[model samples]
Target: MYCLNVLFASQLNHKSILKLIRCCLETQIPILVFESIEYETLADRNHRPSHPCFKPLLFTNRLKIAVEIANAIAYLHFRFAKPILFRIIKPWNILIDKQNIVKLFDFSLSVSIPKGETHIKDVGRGTMGFVAPEYVTTRGCFNEKCDVFCFDVLLFVLLTGQEITDYLRCEKGNKFYLVYDVKKYFVNNRVK
Candidate 1:
């Protein structure tokens, strides 16, 4: 059975295309359903402060959004009989309802681990900075940990109000790696 939740935002003007995937608990029957919802993507809500449609995301709301994202991912990873790995965990794929609850859509890139395996190997596919380096280096050999890595990068985007790839590209010019640049903050004790 596919675990599904439908959300109706009370006051959103723009319609967003979202992909919902239905999966069997014990088997991988990838079913795709297209639904149009009136809501804002997390990328827009977080980064588009100067836009006319911008809604100020409060600090408390940011933490709440983070927790909600975590809960959704946990359900996908642990609640399902066959664990689903959400290969892409970027802001663009995350939607926020009018009530500020996060709606995780776009299961197009998700994969379920085989019944007796700890990981799966596939070709890497994700946004540049959001994709984990180790995942790319191993040619898409990944498990649940890969999502965790990407989620951490999402946290950075939420906090900084900037997309990692865009920010790094503008600042560093040539080399713009999310993990490599984030590591510099930790090394220099700049993360406060």
Candidate 2:
């Protein structure tokens, strides 16, 4: 039910998105599209505004959402003819319709890997905090393990309500030193 973007070539091909859509539909999940421009404008303005829209559902169905996302990812990587690397797997990429069923979306950076290819590219892409350490340092040579790392970060965020980037910064040598120092001060203040 979603319309393809006319200007930008989708990172997710028709076949891949269609397959996932079909799987989701089979499981009784409804996929609907809103005005693309309006959606983008609103999303850009406040990317992480806390809304109570899905809070109750999220807390009540945490396990189900986790399992569904895991299965959907596993299916995309292992069940498909060629593994589709969903380079961005953040919470914002996930959509839940009125039925509370999980449908993965926003495959803007997805890549299809051939059977023998070890890594997709020498340069890393995707959200900074979700990126794998090796990919960031070595500038390449990442696999499903990279996705696993991102997934772990997402899981941490979902469970703790604390941003992974916040934790990553406090570990030292991260770019956001001032933000991390402020966070550390608050944390230490609370402990004492």
Candidate 3:
């Protein structure tokens, strides 16, 4: 793991972009330091659709972002010595470079599954709408599947250009969630 970390750091250093380090402190926390560069957060970009600097994401661009996020999660869960579950997957945690490359940042909510353990149990933690149902119902018993579920929700937002908690304003000022609306539409065969 140490060697792989060094190799990744050196390769990223060559490009002067990212630097990964594994510090053997008392807590054994791994620190990732990214080079300072002008970049836009995915949340900001998506939410500021009418901003002067906001450039609309093309369909292909959105797909590219999704693929990049999936690859990052795959690396964390498969390539590392200890598989990591990214408990929080949201637009706010994603950044887009000038080249439109998606960078998945923020590891604060990530947890590494103990060796020989398939899942971990803890208090459920994550943004509300992006959290997996099982994780919530099971009181935070989760595996990589939780991450996949959150990724699917993020994909829904990416494809539909709708926030997970999107609300429909009615005559009485009542609100309904976008997810519920989608579910209702599918259930009633109105989506077709």
- By lDDT, the candidates rank as 1, 3, 2
Over 128-163, each residue of candidate 3 has an lDDT whose tens digit, in order, gives 677777887789798999899888878777766776
Task: Point to the candidate with the largest TM-score.
Answer: 1
Clashing pairs in 2: none
Give per-residue lDDT, candidate 2, residue 181: 46
Candidate 2: misplaced stretches above 4 Å? 1-54, 57-60, 169-192
Task: Give the clashing pairs for model 1.
Answer: none
Residue-wise C-alpha lDDT for candidate 1, range 22-130, written one tens digit per residue? 3233446533344556778999899887788877798888888888888777767886677878778989888887677777776556777889999888884787877
Please rank every candidate by TM-score, starting with the best. 1, 3, 2
**lDDT tens readout by residue for model 2, 1-192:** 222221112333332132232212233543534322212111211234356433334454545656777776776678666676776777777665444455566655766676778667747477877787777767776677788777766655554456556666765676632334446656887422
Q: Quickly count the clashes in candidate 3.
A: 0
Best by lDDT: 1
Give the 10-residue window scoring lowest on summed lDDT in candidate 3. 9-18
The CA lDDT of each predicted structure is 0.72, 0.55, 0.69
Better of 1 and 2 by lDDT: 1
- Runs of candidate 1 exceeding 4 Å displacement: 1-37, 170-173, 187-190
- TM-score of model number 2: 0.61
